[model samples]
Target: MSMFEKPSQAEQELKWAKIWFKQFSHFHKRGGKANWDFSPDDVILFLRSKRDQRMPAWKRMKILKGLLVYRRFEQELPIDPFSFIVEKMKEIVANERAKQDGYDTIEDVVGVIDPTEPDAIQQFRRALRKDGMRLQTERSYVGKVKAFMADRGLRCLADFASVRASDVEAHLTDLAVDGNVAASTQNTAFHGLLKFFTLVLKRDMGPIEAIRASKGKQVPTVMSTREVASVFEGLEGVHLTIAQLLYGCGMRISEAIRLRVKDIDFDNHLIEIHGAKGGKSRLVPLPDELVEPLQRFVESRRALHEHDIANGTASVWLPYALHRKYPSAHREFRWQYLFASHRLSRDPRTGERHRHHIHYETFPRHLKVAVDSAGIDKHVTSHTFRHCFATHLLWSGTDIRTVQELLGHSDVKTTMIYTHVMNRPGVRIVSPLDRLSEATGRQPAGKSYQEGRIAYAAG
Candidate 1:
């Protein structure tokens, strides 16, 4: 409103300033001491908006920390008024610093700690995404990092460098000591942090060489052949098909559920698994037995799709918009799932309720029941089938490479773990004492057992 101020500049800045003020006012219309506070840099942006100007990209980012500082510390001015005097907003920061320093007790001091410092959680997420981390990995990183920050009172990304490895060591030790986390479990968590520091934070954590974890004493849980059969037979309907796929295709539950109708190539006898783990896709030979069950499922699937379309419920997946591209693709055979969800599911990426495939969680509930009914006499789960699949394949003289490919393992070393279960291929030697005859120079009752069964089976 100054007379000497450039009319165009003054008009542009003040006009948008008022507009932004109204937005905040509207946001806090039902408010007490409306918490929306803006700092000097925020005011600069409001003025910049008026002149139809944007701050230089680098300078633009710097303003967020200032705004965060304003929101967290200064309660005197609304964001709009602060935006005008953003450059002169240093006093509020100093006051916060003074208050932070004023606390005598550790608990009070911790309370005074600024949570919005540099907002590292947000920054770390962006960094991980840019680094092409998987959605699951990104989620894990967020959970682990958020917990770590909350526990240790981290305010900014820069504070990570100050987070001593010893502190992390103590935490890992505590987890192992209190939670009884095995060495491997502890390593996974510690390595997650190591990845965050070395990869995301770009910190020179020096290979985490000294990070030693307590080793875990664990045993592999393998479902017996009889148990596997029992669980396999006890399953029914889609649940049966699901378990069949688990054993038949040697697939994890996650991989089985992600299957689409298009993934199976009946003519080529190939089943394509896309980016199953570690973002790598591979094709495995389709089990011949699965073809029949899959065909039966498809018959029902086609009907379901038709019914859904007729009832305005089918055709859920919509072939990823292929319905629009090809127009007739919705009714096509390739577009139908071999094992389809009766109803459509929403597209997580698009937020559109279009069916993708059978959900991963559905079959497992029924699988546990089948496990109990089969009378396998062991605590087993769906993953037990996958474990048995690899072991059985190895027992049937399947090559390690073939089994590895079928199991979708990136390394042969992972497949080699199953080798321990199959045992070495060698001749069994009987003790000389077993050759002894009884009474009439013939084998006695107990001694004749192996020969009788061997000869009987031979007959």
Candidate 2:
């Protein structure tokens, strides 16, 4: 449509419904044969199928939001389906909150009923949790299996056992050829499926020749000093603080957000990073410039914690077995997140209402806005700051070993990617082309170029 033109109401409704359905697919996918041209009734049937699947309230809300427009215009139903789903979600949330507030007995906390393949997948998740997989790793593994099952029409654990090694291989091949997924994504899915089969389904996927994704050397994107400054110029407040930590402390966004009150030592000028990538801990030097601001930020966090305590909802998420051992630690000020979220949220896993840390997604959203507003052309993510941190440190003559330690990299080689990203592999040397151009007898050929016709040769 042109700028002056508007699409018909039906056209607009269908467009919006499609967008919502795509969003829904991110978290929920039909696990059986689904018609591509699904009607509103198909959507309703799918929702009804998930009644016992133990979906979080927030996710159900997203589904309802997606389907509301479709149900309103495209179909006539006996009841307002969207409103029903909305009320169901609200009830779940309220029940969860009530339980947290001691209004319900322990019996009120319910586990998955009428267990399906999804419930069986939860068993695998519990095993992963017991083995102490990082949250991101768990999500990736679970998501891959969910996507695979959805694609192959695997409705239950019985279907999982029947899947052959060839099936797994073909699925991965399709991800590369059909989905056009990135090499890393393909690798992740491949490994995730193998793991799900072995660990979750308790079946071996032996000797499969899957068409592997092309593995290319990946170098992290780094911003120049001027470009880095430009990103900061557009950001202020907590966003700026988080970005600064990403660049200054060589911390991942997850580590930075999960930083707790007790982790920072103002007197020692060190920040303790616990439960980082690979479940390792390390200390990084706190930037001299950020100390006072960090102190003030901590004060604000403490205030929030005090308010939460008074409101009887001060719990913060603790790493495995710690919360169980130290039940009161969740409510402690020292255990409070350094960058607490503005509002209290219910933990999807435990259904506990508490003030959690700032979500990992929030920083990236703000950083993208800042980077765009600053007119930086690079694809700057929260991680780009980390790349900048390492590269800048190396450029300023920091030893490789020290940089590795600061970066919480288990191996020095892992930290060595900065050398490639910095475009300074091995000892820095002037290019041969530049050297030749600098010679007295030779000027750069392209300095003054002219288009001239060449003489035609007779064959």
Candidate 3:
């Protein structure tokens, strides 16, 4: 085509497709197959590769659309399989364009917290967000700080500025003595107040000499193997899979639900847990029995992702401003949550509609029902499974350091708690009463006087 002449529609589409295919070929070399010998998965991989390179969303979409046009008109290949990609890319392009036009993007929206919230609380929240605190942590901190302000009649920023260390100390003491809050609760409140004064108010808080809440050394609740099996019998489908992950992989409920499709490696028999407690990542061994079930689960998740794509809502929330970095990754299959919620929900932070993982609370509710059905008397929560995981591993002779790493504990001291609860077969200690009975070749007497006399006479 001459410089002044306009290219035909067919020529333009072919050019677009060729440009995309060229880039795709660089990533995936065509040895003996034709240039067009690629599947939807290949197309997805190519798009993801572009995303990783931080390519502009519009450019990526243009190339992909060109490929579709060329394949349909020139190659006469079926375009049905690529429909999901087309729809998802169109949505991405529209969002990018909207952002370019100075429209309010998802990032511009405020969180679900009330707009009429106190200015001090809002400032505290902003500081927490700037520090990359988790949403739950932010809420807790804000609540505690707000309570402190309310209790002290500090209605505004100026009031917060006047807060002294003694005031904080007295308030915490009151929480322990008057409110009767638990040790952890008081400590959480203390930390929240400390952060608010130090970070938000920019004031130095002197040493806190408040009367501390009494803390007790409480062991975690762990289910026996039989009770675990009984609970499993009550749970089915996604809940069962999640419970298994909690116990089998030593994963916290938050870690299990937040899992992405790419995190699971079936061939390696490993699961990658990212952004776990303390913002750490670790690999856990995938149970042999879970391999097939997880495969089937992922396949179903893919189908659900396709449906979301067709509906123009195929996107997930990426942490740490990753969406800004990899614009197309949010819509990729690998980023879709492993255990996605059935319905689309509005993001609290961005106010955008996206499919999040199943709510963390849902598992515990199911677990409570399962525990009750299993006739378990222990107070069982979703976290009990994690405790069971650590204790059972120790019981089965797994090294403590290995268990610590799998549980993602930074210090071995945390993992040592399980050793107290774990039962050792070889080191098992017989009760004194049982030992006495064994030595004398007779059963121990009952506690009642009449039963004790009869048992003594019989012996």
RMSD, every candidate, angstroms: 19.1, 19.6, 19.9
Model 2 residue 430 lDDT? 75
**lDDT leader:** 3
**Lowest summed lDDT over 10 consecutive residues: which window, candidate 1?**
105-114
Candidate 1 per-residue C-alpha lDDT over 1-459 given as tens digits, one digit per residue, 9 for 90 to 100 = 322124586445445444445544444452423455534544454545533563342333334334434344344444444432433333333333334444333222121223453567665655554344555776676676676676688867777878876667666666667767666666666666766775456553442223344664444467767767778788888888788888877887877876777888889999898757776788888889889888787677677776767766444445223444466665555666666665667643235555567766778778878877876666677777788788888877889999988887888988887866644335344545655553348666775798889999999
TM per prediction? 0.58, 0.69, 0.72
Candidate 1: regions farther than 4 A off:
1-119, 155-161, 198-200, 206-211, 215-219, 306-350, 422-459
- Superposed Cα deviation of residue 132, candidate 3 (Å): 1.2
Clashing pairs in 2: none
**Candidate 1 structure lDDT:** 0.62
RMSD after Cα superposition, model 3 = 19.9
Task: Write the candidate numbers in order of decreasing TM-score.
Answer: 3, 2, 1
User: Model 2, range 240-269, lDDT digits (tens) per residue?
Assistant: 998999999989998999899999999999
Ranking of all predicted structures according to lDDT, beginning with the best and ending with the worst:
3, 2, 1
Position 176, candidate 2: lDDT: 78
Give the Å error, residue 403, model 3: 0.8
Q: After superposition, how far is residue 217 of candidate 3 from its true place, in Å?
A: 1.8
